[model samples]
Target: IYLPYTGTTIGSFGYVPMEQMEGGKAYAASDLYSLGTTCFHLLTNVHPWDLWKKQGYRWVNSWRKHLKQPVSEQLWWIMDRLLPESYQHRYQSVDQVLEVLEFQSATPANPSQSTSKYHESFLNFLTSLRQNDQLKKQVMMGGVSLLSLGLITQGYGYFRYQTFPSNLSFLIAGLPSSTYLKTTLNGHTNSVRSIAVSPDSQYLVSGSNDHTVKIWDLPKGELVRTLNGHDGNVYSVAITPDGETIASGGDDNTIKIWNLKTGELKNNLTGHQGFISSVAISSDGKTLVSGSYDHTIKVWDLPTGKLKQTLTGETNWVSSVVISPDGKTLVSGNGGNTIRIWDLDTGNLKKTLTGHRDSVVSLIISPDGKTLFSSSLDRNIKIWDLTIGELKNTLTGHIYYVHSLAISPDGKTLVSGSANNTIKVWNVETGELKNTLTGHTNWVSSLAISPDGKTLVSGSRDDSIKLWKLP
Candidate 1:
């Protein structure tokens, strides 16, 4: 099927697919081609644009030759299907690529000499790219697509927005804002409060004030099923480390766990006397943590739904909770504009981080477990060194309350959703504002970054979830 577009060549050169360049028509596969190009550039440290002027699409055919070291033939095969010059030869759907990804990446040709040996990127086909600092920086490369013009750039936010006279004024400024968006999921009748993506990045789970948790299939952004159980507005949702279970907290003052595949209610844990605001699972998949307006954090055995410990002494209600990747430390953002560091193994408060001027609503840690990022009603994102309990950097730009934060798999980029109806992209290490994305009509309540760092999902108060193709 063909989707008509203007004849102008608006994107950075080589990343544009053949269909977009030849006939002014594009399809879903065009983005696949663009993704493949990004993968290739990550594998070979060569910008696709550098080859576009001379070799054109021909360069994609022999991409492996530029690889500095060995890449499994299996990986090369997947790229073969992705980087093909024609849509017919490419993977017809993103689901198709996801289906075969695991089988092709079971083992590398040379385990010792892996992606890092060739390039610094943690771009693995099936494996968690944060293989070891794999996600140390967010989306390893800035990705672009000419087809949708939605994903302008990745690692650095400079290219994300259709800027004013300072940047590309000729094309994007003349186009509608809808031109910057590819997918918007509308199902929840109330504001979407929080969202999470599966570890594999195939499914999205959103908790809404509509008293429902919705699971959506990726790429297609189609509603897979609607989960109903919470008695009040659903406030937070978290997919387990294994992605087989989903834990949801809400105004109901309860935590409900559901089967990821069957949508069955597996268990409901009741204890909190106040509204449950956040839920988090440890990396080991054995521990569950919840934060509530009851002014306490509860630790439970995830498999049994049995309560293990109740942490108190909080000056304000708990709003958000997150565990380090190592499963040893627990961090909670509290209503008193403070963050409490707890020892998960001992259930003791390790330290208190006080910096925000308002309630801290969101928390996310770098994959390596060395850093912690927190956002608050203060309209700021605070970066802290997790080991020493010291503040590192404070990122400020959001005009309103920062409601959510997500770090790309590369751990390089940090994306924050705000009540101002915008998503701001940041350079995690430098605390610099990369770019601001505008589309949501209401507050951007929640945000999630896919494991591969290719997609960014934002849930809004407008009662819609938008799937963004990362740059």
Candidate 2:
């Protein structure tokens, strides 16, 4: 479980400062201690305490021989740092610890080689020490001889270290244009702010600032149904994956759930106090998340317009919200330039990511729920390490504010729309700029990709949405 102020310790026993340990006043190293102990448990299915009995407690020993799984050396180093008996010897900061874990070591050691290296080094050093008394002269000669050999070995190793190969990691390649098709539906008087394609891709639903939501017959680009209810601008819209119901939230501080077949409003969720900024329906279709300028995010039951939970504490307006594909976690972005993660079952704040410089306008979680993509008025998109809530990298290319973002179904490509009237696609793994779609005449307001990951649709301030065939 995630703790509040109590820091995480990393050792056989979760040792927090005696004072802070109570009511959970733990140090960050406490997490490290837990990690090390957990590592030991995962490796042997035996608790660290069971390995060695200590004073009314169990301590883990045989630190070198026990852990046999495929783990990075840097992580082992961190585990050691955390399990130190004295806090002074433990990792002082998370950054320092992460640096070691992230440091690209020159070689990927095989388990046998790693074990041999450790044992050989230890034996060599011990042998040299055993001969220390008899002949001080021999000791001096041995020291000089070993020093010269060590320098030569290091110099050669530095110059001959193997260069690791780089390989392209693409999740979804754009479909070849010769075999692809395109279609565009024209109806709304203003720019479309959000679009949701039915699971079968036969129907497309769009909401616009024109205060109307329209459903279009896909592949033919023909208007099918128009649902009108909002009194103000409609900023966002989402359709259930089953293609049965539609949910739209707007500047009116209300969310309306529509029956797709009958074009009837089933329920109007009206608890938000300010403009509705974004909305998302969980994969299970039972929960709906709505974020608003009121600085709170509300989780509601779709079938009954009842409030399930209210997530508050954002210092500024909550601009966007998304639930992971699994529906177990909720992520919300705010004008305070922060991203807060919540546990859906317990309705508790899990983490607060504070790295963005300007208002965070949009957020998209990866399909595997391992990473989060956030766009902000700061003119950059940030990829975050979700598990630890660390900023992995900042992608820069947009000359203006980034408005909307979408990740390809394969998760390798990230497409973002910007106020510069361009949609840029990026290689998410390498942070490389792939291509820029520049057909729009004004600022691009929103973006969407076909389920097959070939066609890209972008809504722009020019009051038109264009279809771009990926190259």
Candidate 3:
């Protein structure tokens, strides 16, 4: 039995301590020891093997000194019981650990009472672990039953007294609310063309025809800063996954990168001859892809702003660009009513997907990078199989041209903004229209989903941005 880290695997058994490996027999206490090591590593920001090589079990005794937060005596006692070098001295059963945790919960040992920041940070770390599919599968297969229970208890203890955003409740699998408009942000002097949200969900950036980019405090809908650098109408905007940089493309035929926190210009990329229309950053945040009226897509080195590759096979103006999560494939929608898939490593065309009767206006790849969603001026949204390059389904609900599309973080729901002044939410797998959001009085030009999958932001030609509480 073992506790898997980010890069650990079952085949990598040499990582086990020498004493545990020599026995060739795993006990319940062995599992507890491994979990305790994992907890110590996470708390101290050091690898277990490094500490074991230097100081053996003595590393556990000094772990508290390395922690960023103060640990309570009850918690320290629990940790001590789990890290004993002798199996007889360690925890013998899952029930024993739970009993300790339950008793600790009743006392003032709760981390939230003394160090709320530490508890919040630890909660975020556990939430990320739960979201990791590979780690979850490995733990289930390894049969580490107690670790699962411990994670659940920790989650409950942290979240029980904390208040989350109202829309967060709707992110649950079966909990659907009556969708409603939450607030309207009115700062763009002209039609808002594009929008992007930071990965932390704390800030929103919007590009407008007024030739400026505005950053807003997401929850409060208050304007934070106005960026005025573009000489032409800003057409597209994107935020890096790290939430440190902002990229925008405009009719000035240039791509500008800015420091998101400081609002300072970082780099200016120039190559496109026509108006830039769409921009997307790879999941790794190393590559930036942009599409323009020049009928081409250009890939750039994000840090240096140097051109890496230019794709120029499209016959019409490129309207949308998206990169697969793996950063191996690039997908672009063109005014020629087609979608093209390119191999990022080789800069070669892989396939052309054709189904829309009119120009393809927006494109988004599913979270798993298996399905491609495209919206078109044909008034329809087409779902395509990324592996086989075939159309799987077509959703027809919008009365006018569909302008933009966004998928939830879980890839379970899709929202499309249309020229008919309405936004439609659909079940991605079933192609069923779940709800129709009607608030924008003019054409909805852009759409973005928050990283938490709870809030949906839409920008319109009506010169306003609306935040929708998703169901």
Provide the clashing-pair count of each candidate structure.
13, 14, 0
**C-alpha positional error of residue 452 in candidate 3 after TM-score superposition, expressed in Å:** 0.7
Best candidate (score: lDDT): 3
**Ranked candidates, highest TM-score first:** 1, 3, 2
Candidate lDDT scores, in order, read 0.75, 0.67, 0.77
**For model 3, how does the per-residue alpha-carbon lDDT over 1-471 read when each residue is reduced to its tens digit?**
344332334322323533365554556666666766666655567776777678755455345556666543335445656775545446665555644444333334333354654355445544554567675545544645446444434533443343211122222233232346888999987789999999999999999988999999998889999998998779999999999999999988999999988899999999998778999999999999999988889999999899999998988889899999999999999877899999987899999998897678899999999999999866789999998899999998775569999999999999999765678889998998887777676679999999987789999977899998876
Clashes of 3: 0
* Candidate 1 steric clashes: 13
Q: What is candidate 3's TM-score against the reference?
A: 0.63
RMSD of each: 22.2, 20.4, 24.8
Put the candidates in lDDT order, highest first. Answer: 3, 1, 2
Give the alpha carbon lDDT tens digit for every residue of 1-471 in model 1.
122244644465677788788766665567677777877776688888888777766676457668876644335545766786666446655445544543222323343333332221212322343243433222222222321121212211211111111212121222354544678999998789999999998999999988999999986889999999988779999988788999999977899999999999999999999778899999889999999877899999999999999999886778899999999999998867899999999999999998897678899999999999999866789999999999999997764568899999989999898765778778887877766777887778899989977888999877899988664
TM-score of 1: 0.63
Off by over 4 Å in 3: 1-179
- My TM-score estimates for the predictions, one after another, are 0.63, 0.61, 0.63
